[model samples]
Target: MPFVHIELVAGRTVEQKINLVKEVTEAVVKNTDAPSEKVHVILNEMQPENYAVNGELLSQK
Candidate 1:
């Protein structure tokens, strides 16, 4: 079994996420020989206000 965690800024369309998950699953399955059914992918979307860099919130930038 393979578990993949992906984190990114929120706002992507559903089609983008669908392609991402499908491509990611294909990669994992090819590289690790993990069964497609056993592979898991979790996507974490963070609001701009919740992320920061250089002491400044992303929302502020």
Candidate 2:
């Protein structure tokens, strides 16, 4: 089994998220020899205010 964790600022559509996971699963399977069903992808969506860079919150950008 292969575990993949992805974090991003919230706002993407459902279709986009679906495509992201599907593509990610394919990549994992191709590179790690893991079965599609055995690959685990965890997506963590955070609010812009909860993410920051260089002392500035994403929401402020």
Candidate 3:
């Protein structure tokens, strides 16, 4: 089994998530020989207010 974790800023549309999972699954299948059913993909969405860089919140940037 192969597990993948992706952390992204929140607010992506459903379509974007769909495309991301599909494309990532295909890549995992090709590189690891793991079937789609055996590959696990985790999407961690964070709010801009909850993320920061260089002492500045993403929402403030």
lDDT measured at residue 58 in model 2 versus the true structure, 0 to 100:
90
Clashing pairs in 2: none
Q: How many Å off is the CA of 40 in candidate 1?
A: 0.6
How do the residues 1-61 of candidate 3 rate in per-residue lDDT, one tens digit apiece? Answer: 7999999999999999999999999999999888889998899999999999899999998
lDDT of 2 by residue, 4-61 (tens): 9999988999999999999999999999998899999999999999999999999899
Model 1 Cα shift for residue 4 (angstroms) = 0.7
Tell me how far the alpha carbon of residue 10 in candidate 2 is from the true structure, in angstroms, after superposition: 0.4
Considering only N, C-alpha and C atoms within 3 Å, which residue pairs clash in candidate 1? none
lDDT of 2: 0.95
* Deviating ranges (above 4 Å) for candidate 1: none
Backbone clashes under 3 angstroms, per model: 0, 0, 0
| Runs off by more than 4 Å, candidate 3 | none
TM-score of 3: 0.89
Provide the lDDT at 45 for model 2: 97
